[model samples]
Target chain A: MNRTTELHPFSVPRYPSGNPAQRVIVQVLVTQDAGQQRHAQLLARADTELRHLALPQYADEAALGEALATLLSEARVGVHLELHGDEAFIWSLCGVARAAGLLGDEITLQCNESGRRMLFCVHCASLQAGTCADLQPCRQCGVMLEVRRHFSERLGAYLGVCADADQPYAQARP
Target chain B: MSALDARVGETRLITPVIREVSLMPVNGTLPAFSAGSHVQLHLPNGKRNAYSLLSDPGDTSHYRIAVRQQAQSRGGSRYVHEQLQTGDQLKISSPANLFPLHSTARLHVLIAAGIGITPFLAYCTELLRRGAAFELHYAYRAGLSDAYVEVLREQLGEHLHLYESSARRLDLGQLLGHRPLGTHVYACGPQSLLDALREQSLALGWPAARVHWEAFAAPEPGVPFVVELARSGRQVAVGAEQSLLEALESAGVELPNLCRGGVCGQCRTPYLKGDVEHRDLFLAHEERASSLMPCVSRGCGSPILLDI
Candidate 1:
C-alpha cells in the first residue's frame, strides 16, 4: 500500500511549538545536526526560559541515560519536555521521561524528517536503522521483509514481517 | 452501602480538642482501606459524620480516626467528645476514598492544616512502605491543634516540615512555587487553607490534575427551601440549618453518597427546575446547568424538582 495518511498508521506527527500553560520548557536533543533548527523554533515560541540538553552522538549512552534520569527526577510540576531526534533516539529518551513520571501531555516528540527510520524485523527479532523502504532484507536473518504501518513506541521501530511467505529469505526479493 | 458493626476499642486525647478514637469490628475482620479513605460514623445523637481513617492501611483489625471538637458542634463532634466511650457500639459505613494519591506522581507533596493531618497519616505510612519519595508540610498551632507532630517528626525525620500557625503563618505561595516535575501536591484542611492552596497552585501554572485537596468542614447551612422528588412525587422541606441530602434522608429517601462534603461527585442529581446555588467543588460550569450536588447545593426561593 502507498504511504497515504489513511494507509499508514505510523504517520509523522505534527508537534506544537510550546504550551503557554507550562511554567518550564526543557528541550532534549539526541544530535545537534538536524535538531538545531527544530530547537531554535521551539525556543522562539517558548515564553519561559528553555533548558537545553544535547546528547553528543558518540558519547557513552549509558552515562547520558543516567544523567537524563537524574535531571528528570528533579523536574518540577509544570515542566514540559520537547524531544528532537530520529525515531529511535527520541523514543529512547521519551521512555526515560515516561519512567520518570512525565505524562503524555507534558511531552512533545519531533522526529527528524530524514528518510532514515528504525525497522524491527519480526522474524529475526532484529532492529535495523537507516532508510525507509517498503521491502528490505533483515540484516541478521536475511529474510525478505515488508515494512508494515504498525509502529511500536516502546521498541522505537516500525514492524517488518516476512514478505510473500510462500518465498522466504533473501532469494524472495528477486 | 452496608454498615459495619463496630465498638470503640480505645480512645485517647491527641490534643486538648482532638481525640484519637480506635474502632474494632464487632464481627469478622474489617475491610481493608487505602490511604485517604474515610468512613461515615453513625454518631450517638443520630447524626452521621465522616472521618478519615488515620491508621496504617495494612491493619484490618481496627481503624483509627481523630475527631476535633468543633465549638459550633452540630451534635456529632460534641457527642463523640463528651459521651462516646470505649466498648460503645457504633455503626460505620464501608470505607470510601475521595482523595486518593495521584497514580503516576513521582514525588508526593502532602500539605495539612490542624486536624487535616489525619488522612496524611495513612499516606505517609503507605508512601514509606513503597519506598517512594515524599514530603509532608504541616501547619498547626503548637498546643491547640498539633495532634501528630511528635510521632510524625520521629518517623519522617527531615521529610516532615512543620509550621506552627500560632507562631507564624504558613507561606502558601512559596510552598506551591518551585516544585519539581512529576510532583503531585495533596492538601487537606479547613476551607480557608484549601482555598489559599488552590489559588497559589493556579497562579504557579500548576495543572489542576496535579493539585488535590479535601475540605474537612461539613456543608454550611443555607436558606431554607423545598425539594420535590420527580420519581416518588414526594416533597421534603429542607431547613435553613439542614442540608438537602440530610433532608432527603430524614424523609426516608436515600441516595447513594460518599464524601457528603461535595468533592466526590457521587450524589450529583439532575434538576429540572430551580434557582440552584451550587457550592460543590466538583462540577464544571456547563454541568451546573443540568445537575446539582444536593449534598452541599441548595435551592433559592423556588422548590427544586429533582430527578432523584
Candidate 2:
C-alpha cells in the first residue's frame, strides 16, 4: 500500500496565495490566456504594493527570465512572487527565483492548467510534464517511470523512479 | 555534555567589565565551531557560564571567548576576572551553536551591542570567507566594552558601522527599511536591543524568520522554590542565588541542556502542576502553560511538579 505522506502541489489551492504582509508582491503571467488575470487582480490591496508582468504569446522566456532576475536582485526582504502559468512554466521560473536567493515561502505558484504534473526522472535527471498518472515513460531516457508523491520545492517537480527494476530503460530499436 | 580539559593560553582585559581569554586543548586541537557557537566554561567556583566563541570558527588551534563580568557576578565571571590566569586548567563543554547563520540569505545584516560582538566576530570571518554580502552595525562605547574594534575595523572596513555614544544611537527604522530581498538580519545584545529589533522588524513588515537574535541576558536571581519530581517523588529546593537548572543538576537529576541562559529549547520540561515564572526566550506564551524551560524559568510560590 502506497501511503500518500508526501505533499503533492495539488494538495494546496491552485494559487497558494501571496502573503498580505509582504512589502511587495509581483505576479508573473507566463501565458496571457491562462485566464488568471482576474484572480491576480483580486490580490491587490491598499497596504501592500502589487505589480504584474505578462509574457507575450509565443515569446522567448529568456527575456522574462532576465527581467525576473533583475527584479529579484533589486527586491527587498519582504517581497513575495506569484507565478500564474502551467505547471512547467511556473516550476521553471521557481527554479530561477530559487537561484536568485528567493526561498520557497517567498514564491507562490498558481497553475492555470492543472491535472498535468511535472515529474523529474531519476534515471536520466530530466524533467517531463504529463497527465496525473501513476506510471509514465521518461521522455528523455525512454524508461518506464513511477511518479512519487514526494515533491521537491527546489526542483519544483515530483520524484519519478524506475517503475520496473528488471527493465530500467526501454529497449532500443534495431 | 562531556567536558574537554583545556589550558588557558592567554588572557586580556578588554575593559573593566570584560575579559578575553584564549583556551588551548590539553590533548589535541579543539573541534571546529560555526559562527554563533558558544561553550560552557565550568568555572573554578563551581559555576558554569556560557561564552560565545570570538575567534575564527574554522581555526580550532585554540578557542577564544570574551567574558563580561556581570554586576551580579554569580562567582563565574568573578572567578575568571580575579583568579583565573595563564596556564590554569579548565573544563569547557564542546561548542554548541544555538544561534546560527541563515544558510540561504543573500545579504546578512548583523547588529551587535557591546560585548555581544563576540559571536559576530566569528560571523564576520565566516561570511567573508564565503564571500557573502554583509554589514555589521556595532553599538559600543569607546574603550569601555569595545573589545575588538580595531581588529574589526581592519577586517570589515566599509561593512562595519559603529555607534559610539547615545548621541549616535542605532536607528532601527532606517536600518531595517528597504533592503534587497532575501536579506537576513541578526541581532545579539541586551534584551532591550533585541526587543527593539523585533518590534521594528515586525513594524517594517519583516518576517519573523528573517530576523534572528541571540540574547546575552542571563537568568536573574529569583524567589526560592521547590521542584517535586513526579516519578521519583523527590523534592529539590532551589535557592534565590541558583538557577532552576543548576539546582536540578546539584540534585543529581540528569537533564539534557545547552545554552543554559534559556534560548535553546533543550531543557524544556512538561509540568503537571504549579505556577511558573517563565524567563526563557524560547517558549511561546501558550506553550508556557504546559511546559517550561528549566534553564531560566522557575517555579513560583508553590511546589512545581515536573514530568521528568
lDDT of 2 by residue, B232-283 (tens): 9999998887888888888888688878888889889999999899998889
What DockQ, on C-alphas, does every prediction get?
0.42, 0.46
Model 1 lDDT at residue B68: 97
In DockQ terms, which candidate is top? 2
Candidate 1: clashing pairs of residues: A75-B180, A75-B181, A76-B180, A76-B181, A77-B180
For residues A90-117, write the lDDT of model 1, one tens digit per residue: 6667788888877766677766645466
User: Which segments of candidate 1 are over 4 A away from where they belong?
Assistant: A1-22, A25-47, A53-78, A111-174, B44-46, B102-106, B176-182, B202-205
The residue-level lDDT of candidate 2 at B34 comes to 93
Candidate 2, residue B23: Cα displacement in angstroms equals 1.4
Model 2 segments beyond 4 Å from truth? A1-44, A55-63, A111-115, A162-174
Query: Can you write out model 2's per-residue Cα lDDT over A20-138, one digit (the tens) per residue?
Result: 44444344333434445554664556556655556663356677777788877777666777777766677778788878776666677766544576889988899777766888898
Q: For candidate 1, what is the TM-score?
A: 0.82
Task: State the C-alpha lDDT per candidate.
Answer: 0.81, 0.81
TM-score of chain A of 1: 0.75
- lDDT digits (tens) for residues B283-305 of candidate 1: 99999988998888989866789
